[model samples]
Target: MDFSGAIFEGGAYFLKAKFEGGAYFLEAKFEGWAYFLEAKFEGDVNFSGAIFEGDVNFSGAIFETRGMFAHVEKIEEEVKFSGAILNRVFFEDTDLTKIRFYGTAIENAYLAGANFGNKRFIEEREAIDEERNLLQHITKALKKPGLKSILKSMFVFFAFPDNSYRKIKTKCKPISEAFRRAEDVYRNVKLSLQNEGDYETAGEFYYKEMLMRRKRTLYEIKNLKYWLFSHIYSKLCGYGEKPLRVILAAFFVILFFGTFYWLTGTVTGEGITDSSFDYYYFSVVTFTTLGFGDIHPVSFTGKLATMLEALTGAFMMALFVLVFGRKMLR
Candidate 1:
């Protein structure tokens, strides 16, 4: 049944309607509420460029084959699809901020270019409660079969990159349950974006996923060793992104040991020099493992400090090489 370009000025109802063949509603406009309760489409259906000035309900509807509703320009109010089954639906280039998908089965859905709106921090308790309710609705929708695939397809649409880092850290930080699921969602999105050759965006999502993992490890896993390692690896070197951090760390280590040597008077040069410069120079040489015969450590503390500095230098140098190599390769 073709209703292409048809205009329904009043409310439209197709309750329990069955379409055995292709159903077309291209560019249709609904001025009032539109309901398709329990309707079934057995063949391909198209509602591309449709406009609904009022709320649209598709509760209990079923699309057995492929369907398209791409480029829906306007939906005046919320669009409900509770208990609906959609097969291979296309919602590209649509705004879905007010779309409700409670108990909706979205199989092989394509949501590229769709806008899920920005998520802001809700400070008010009432607003937070509302957001929680909304989250619950979305969670219920995600309970469909093949949940991973559905999440992968819809992630890029809903996870818009509007100051995402700050949003995730501040206002839009997911609840514990959502945070766990977000790890998988971000990972899948990253992989998908990478496959599509969007490396820049993929890298951003990868970082977000890593941040989520870090939080999970710190709060949920409660492993101090792993958490410490992750913290150092990430902040000290930005997961191999910032090579300068290595140099900075090395500088601090040199300064600390140099001060120690000066205060303790444990470093000696070939001459009777007890200058700060001499101590600093000795510290640098020792850190670099350059055991110059001109200068040596005199005390046990100096020897221990020298060994520690040498180990630190080697480790930092190795890390710098690895990080630099990774950046260069990328």
Candidate 2:
């Protein structure tokens, strides 16, 4: 439901409906699913500290400005951002992507089917950024009795990434072992993403340490978020249409040779002798280097034909091998 262009201003509100700036959702919230597909914006759009019970589908949604999502609590359901275009995306210490909240529409976080930025969650978080005035915010949040419970749950995600289990082993005892165990899981998750060409995520494990040591967000603490984005964007989108082009080139070569070979084997003489078994077989053997001597060329054109067939064979094989290898690596 788009109406923001007709309403909304530069402040926050607890609205009962949607936000649409011509179609941008800027900084607004609904009580349930938030939909703002096909919206255009001129500045940053923030969806900070909002909640949704249903899937967050932003497929094909275009944001001319950066998109900010943070502090969304208890959204234990699938969160989809497929095909949503944006200038920048921010996920600040968001635990929902890593921790599945119980109840509501989500029975389990896995069942929630959360897909964070190309299915690569847990990017280099611990770096200088997470530490962003760590003492300031943690101390501030710690003072609020209301935030204590949530922060305790949030610690399951924040503190456990580095096999901190041993370093903090005696620091926390017995039941707190779950915290260490969770840290191991977090590290494994980060490792898996790193293995799957998600270095930004794997890097987060190290970055998180950077933050914990220094106490801040990577950008705020170290200004490395810019570098992180440069690396992540390239890996995610990669080289577009190169693979597609190789496929097209292959088809073109196949079409050219298939037609040429088919025509070459056609009966061009008055009575047609040796059909095309000899010609096609000759082409195959010539291309494959299996030069059996039973088939001898009697004419100038026939002997010349053998040489051309051999050349085509080499070219096609080389081209196909290159194309196949590129696809496999991609």
Candidate 3:
């Protein structure tokens, strides 16, 4: 069934609807609530370039074959997909921050350029209260028995439906089910991007997934070890996704050991000198394992520090290579 360019001014209710063949909704506009609860699609379903201006729901819907829901400019309200079965769906080049995927089943979904929740949760949640309040007021007024009250309600809605009914603000509260659901969605998206061979984007999603887990473990689960491990991983190398972090880490390690050697004093051909550059040079040489023998550590603490610097340098060099290579290849 083709619904291309159709306008759902009031709403698009397809509750429990069944489509035996391909279902198309290309470039359709939904100006109000859109309900597809428990709907079934036997073949490919397309909704490319659709516009949703209000609440959207696809709870418990099933797509038996490939589906497309791409190229949407924006969605004014949070989209509910709780318990939906999305099989081989494409959501490329779409903003996905407002999409709630709680309990949703997904397989082989393409989400390239689809944004998951970031710091915009608070910003988005705050922006929608005006429209929501206006709508609630209108709904409550229209429920009265008198026709005059209904007209007055409609007038009030037209006049005070502020914020242009365009966008809504949304933020996921901490230690809530929404937070956990978002974490799950991030994990699924990360795996899906990985399967698509988009490793760089996959790495970003992986970072978000790990971040969500870290926050949950720290705040809700209260697991100190897990939180510490995750925090260290992020601080050290951004979970293997950031080459710059690795580079910075190496720089700091070199500087730290160089300062240590300078303070402890190293022996040279002319005997120990207080020159900072000399100790720094010795530190670099020892770190790279390029022992020049022109300068050596006489103190036991200095010698032990050299060995430790060598091990750290090797590890940092290896890490930099790995992360840099991944970034370049991706």
CA RMSD per model (angstroms): 7.9, 20.7, 14.1
* Worst lDDT 10-window in candidate 1: 121-130
Models 1 onward score TM values of: 0.66, 0.28, 0.54
TM for candidate 3 is: 0.54
Q: Tell how far residue 312 is off in model 2, in angstroms.
A: 2.5
Error of 1 at 36 (Å): 2.3
User: Candidate 1, residues 185-243: lDDT per residue as tens digits?
Assistant: 66776676566555555565665566656666654555778878878887778766678
lDDT of 2 by residue, 215-290 (tens): 1222133446654653432232222212344445434544544345547553133323456544555455666557
Candidate 3, 1-330: lDDT as tens digits: 999999999988899999999999999989999999999999999989999999999989999997898888779997887778877777766777688766676666555445543313221122222212222322332233331112211111011112321342222342333345445655665565566565666687677667767765664555799889899889988988887887787778888888887765644545346668877787788778888788887878877888898898888888889878878877
- Candidate 2 residues lying further than 4 Å off, grouped into runs, are 1-68, 71-275, 296-301, 318-330
Per-residue error (Å), model 2, residue 206: 26
Candidate 1 segments whose C-alpha is farther than 4 A from its true place: 119-181, 190-202, 212-228, 241-306
Tell me the whole-model lDDT of each prediction, alpha carbons only: 0.69, 0.40, 0.67
Where in model 3 is the C-alpha error above 4 Å?
A: 117-271, 281-330
